[model samples]
Target: MNAARGGGSVENGIANFAPLAATVFLALVMLLPVGTGVANVMMPHFVLIATFYWLLRRPVLMPYGACAAIGFLLDLWLDVPLGLNMLMLLSTRLFILSQIKYLRGQTRLVQWLVFALFTLILYTLSWFAVALAKRDWLPVEPLFTQWLVTTLSYAPVALVIGRLRRVMV
Candidate 1:
């Protein structure tokens, strides 16, 4: 019976690991579309936001190594400047990781407040960097639109992820 229990535990550990891998894989896949020859409109960075949540929620699982890997993938797949996403991701992770204490069991208002500021900062920084890197004299109109959509959508997604964790637990 003990051996059976041990074997089951091992199997379950392997099973649990699958989804984590899938999430990382999907994150990479999401960035790849921008690199292809097909014309694509710029969308808000989903993987960055999702990775931010996972890092804050479970830092042990989403360490700097994972974030760096994801950032490198973003650089390659999105054709963004090398180290642009890496720097953005690292700074953002550090900022969010610092606020994890306030996020625990917080009110919805608090979460929205935090995410709103963070998203604005992220979008603005990316906008500035892209404008510099690509040498495009584009305006900030689309940047704000993307920020609006991302901020409006990110909270609900994080909440759903939280709820899913509860159900699983």
Candidate 2:
């Protein structure tokens, strides 16, 4: 085992798990249905939430290129416009990093609240862009609903993630 600076160390065997887990998490998140909402099902936006986490805890781990790649993979996997998710992911990473100063050492509740607000903002911006260009509002409702579900999901995930940060980072 090699020790990272500041007393962090991991077995060579476990080093491979981080990216693998991210891949699986991305896969599962893309696959999972948001819920049974008749108007807004199939709306899980895990990439954004996952992006939120990486931006806060592992900026080096989940970089802009990684976000873009994941976004491309998501586009391929989900049949969406290429670069739609990529651009969103890129913008989101930038947004979070820009606001990174505000996230440090905050309570878990505060973190979640801030992220939820950020998610809502990103969703709105995306929807606004698409709506303006395509003259379609279909994405708006889904955006709101996905924010709700994603934020709700973020609470528990972040709690577990919060505990794991010291080890994961």
Candidate 3:
């Protein structure tokens, strides 16, 4: 009986960390060289997918602080303006957290649709922020391509995270 209780506790501890582990893992993916043939089509936003997934599915497990840390790390890894990704992620977290009461318990399709819409907004916001910081307007083509690719990436990435959640929780 003692062994069983210990095992349960151990499982619970690991379960608590599952969401965070998943998010960090996705952030690492953002660093990979997966650019497209297009002139400036950057890699899809893997970090956003993970952040949105955990934020929507298990907000308690994934805190805003952790999101900020991951965003900071991503900014460093991707070499973007310091705190740019951090601001983007924190804003996304806050936006979703505000609407989470309504989003919770909704069907997966609804969740995915909402996420796609959020991705659009996030990409635009990030693009504008970067441009404003640099004091110049960057072309929108690459940003649009990145947004489209990142939006398309949500389905597969969310499916993986959902499956992991089922096993972990």
Candidate 4:
């Protein structure tokens, strides 16, 4: 049976995977050595942005399990304490879901502001976690720089993801 005849279609099935695929791609890209020195410290959290965008725009396609999986993968790749990224990503999803009603219909500026606020909170938590894991206090400058860069990069990342969502999902 065809989609018009009330059966699942191939395109629909593939589209359902787009969010996960895009997110994983972004996560991999985050591992690339694209910057130097301060630029490296300022590297935006592309995976975080992608996860947030997909969760906000299409929650059904980007669920908690997927978030956990992506985080786990990143933690392994980055050689951080296992589950650090998973915890952060899961926390982000939970926070966004709780505020979805308020976030869904807002303007881009409003959304960006909320994202910035959340990113600040998330990075703070991350800093604490890393410090605890290493049994020593870490420098705040890199975390602060990353938080600012990631927050600022949200708009463009969202725009690109939004366009991809329209075309693929």
lDDT of each: 0.70, 0.71, 0.85, 0.89
RMSD of each: 4.2, 3.6, 2.5, 1.6
lDDT of 3 by residue, 60-145 (tens): 88888898998899899888889988888888789889999999989988988898888788888889889988999999988888
* lDDT measured at residue 152 in model 1 versus the true structure, 0 to 100: 76
lDDT of each residue in 128-155, candidate 4, tens digit only: 9899989999999888888988998899
Name the candidate that leads on lDDT: 4
Ranking by lDDT: 4, 3, 2, 1
Candidate 1, residue 23: lDDT: 49
- Model 2 spans > 4 angstroms off: 1-20, 32-43, 163-169
Cα TM-score per model: 0.75, 0.76, 0.88, 0.93
lDDT of 3: 0.85
Per-residue lDDT of model 1, residues 52-74, tens digit only: 66666666666677677777877
- Candidate 2 overall Cα lDDT vs. reference? 0.71
Better of 2 and 3 by TM-score: 3
lDDT for model 1, please. Answer: 0.70
